[model samples]
Target: MNNFTIYLATLLCLLASKVVGQETFETRAKNIAAKIETITKEEKSALKEEVEAVNNQLEKGSITLEQAENKKKVLAEARAINIEARVGKEQENLKNLVQEKVDGKISESDTIKKSNQLILKWEKGDKKHIAKNEKRTTSQFVFAAGLNNLVTDGKIEDSDFRFLGSHFYELGLTYNSRLAQNSNFLHAKYGLSLMYNNLRPTDNQNFVINGEQTNLETNPIHLKDSRFRNVYLVAPVHLEFDFSGSETKGNKRYFKTHQNVRLGIGGYAGFHLKSKQVLKFDDSNLEATEKSKGDFNTSTFIYGLSSYIGYKETSLYVKYDLNSLFKNNTINQNNISVGIRFDLN
Candidate 1:
């Protein structure tokens, strides 16, 4: 309760604070040391114990063989990875501390040398860089060319040229690739086929007499006498796949062999040029002007599904036109064809 007692109490309080502060720093330093030791030993020991647990469960029939194997592998890898990351962070912190203290009193001349060496080490330490050096691109483009066939048959109005033949020379382009988790690259390709037909179409009356359906060849007639010489075009789009294997496999890792089956579904659109029609029996020798349904029914924009599969340099392709070939009341045609393709990419 006196001034001397108060002064003595204040001095003791200040001395106690100084002693506590030093002990607190010492406690923090001990904690850091303990953390480092645990990371270096105890954590790894615990992970190993977890792995042993999985192995024990495996031996006891509590887990399937595959499950045990997966568990062991995943556990080991994850533990290693997590521990490595923690170790890396600690190492980085240590390096930063060392660098600060070492550079604090060192001459500036050694800065560039140390910095360059550190960068070199970092680059070499990167796992991604190592993986990238050995990994390949997982995508590719395809090109194909082949003989194409076009066959669409339907009844003509009031006449009989019931059958006609049309053919096309084909050209194609494709782009394909794979995503992670799946080996096969999803593919898309398109083709253009130009056809030239030299056959003429005729329609005649078939009279049923005496309970017999007979072609009245005796009286021949022509309703629309049309000949298409060089005027049919086809364009097809498809999405397909190569099922042989993933890029992490035999040829994809070696000779880059594209040996697999690829099937696609898409649509096709086209145009018909140079159409002709003859309208009379006596006009058999007469060639009437071809009226290209160019008005409203001329061009066919058919979009249907297509697919294919093949291997190596050869692949199969199928295309169907969903859109009607003709705008007329008559179902002129939706196309279908199967053919081989060649890869150019």
Candidate 2:
């Protein structure tokens, strides 16, 4: 009689487990259906709002009717694609849930929690919303370093500064704004930058200020190193052309600049911040260093034309100053530089 009792209890337990498993599966399936419906509704509402915005633009004459229609079509197609993709992902989750149940990986006690977590994951992983909300203006950090020299009387060969020793560096923040509401091909880039231009004279020469003129003269101490540096705070403006393609997500398209081949033409204007000279020499078998701060007759105002051609974030950059390097001198000398530039976004 005890054996029969044990068998009956085991049978009851098996039936109860089957019933609970069936209930769990039913509950998860219902939750998946509801989540899919919610996703569709959200995308549809967003699409409606976007369409309304296009209509308003058309009414305001900001965009023509034909353009508005084209925009609406593109938006609709994008939204439809988003809905299809998101819903397909939810369906995949449901399939995985069934597979987990078949493999006995899911427990009845945690089924509801797991299903809720899956829905939450779907919400968090949706990148379409983020892509659709891209801003019209973006900012990036700019850094440039390269060879520095001067063009004396419009001739580079007559430069007094060492070709390889002289260097220039720039640091700044820039903003890029799309020129058109719908196109990313053209943009206006503007920013402020701090520029450092260093010149190392060749042939044991050092800069000497005589009266109103700054001239390079032979140093009597047989100098090992002599450098003159000028600092400037400048504002630069450029019209940039970006060839990177646009990406469509949901109801909007975003143009990411500096992702491909780009060309920029611009100019800058500012004033000299300060100037200093450094000298290092051997004096009586001892190393001596001298630092002198002065204007050195350097120009107080700075203006230059700059340009760049590049792929992605790095580019070949060149700039030439329009103003004279010195305030009063017999010969006109202008600073020039060529280097690699990076735009860190």
Highest lDDT model number: 2
81-122 per-residue lDDT for model 2 (tens digits): 576578667657656655665677757667556556655754
Write model 1 residue lDDT over 1-345, tens digit each, in one string: 432233233223222322322333223323433444456355457766997899899889999989986676566446545654674554454344334433554333454455555458655665553444234332222323233233345332333333323222333233343433333455445544333323333344322122222122322435343333233444565555556553343222422325655565666555443333222333657544433221123333335565656765456765554554444524354434455544433
Each model's lDDT: 0.43, 0.77
Off by over 4 Å in 1: 1-164, 188-226, 229-236, 246-257, 268-296, 330-332
Supply the TM-score for candidate 1: 0.37
Clashes of 2: 0
- Lowest lDDT sum, 10 consecutive residues, model 1, at 206-215
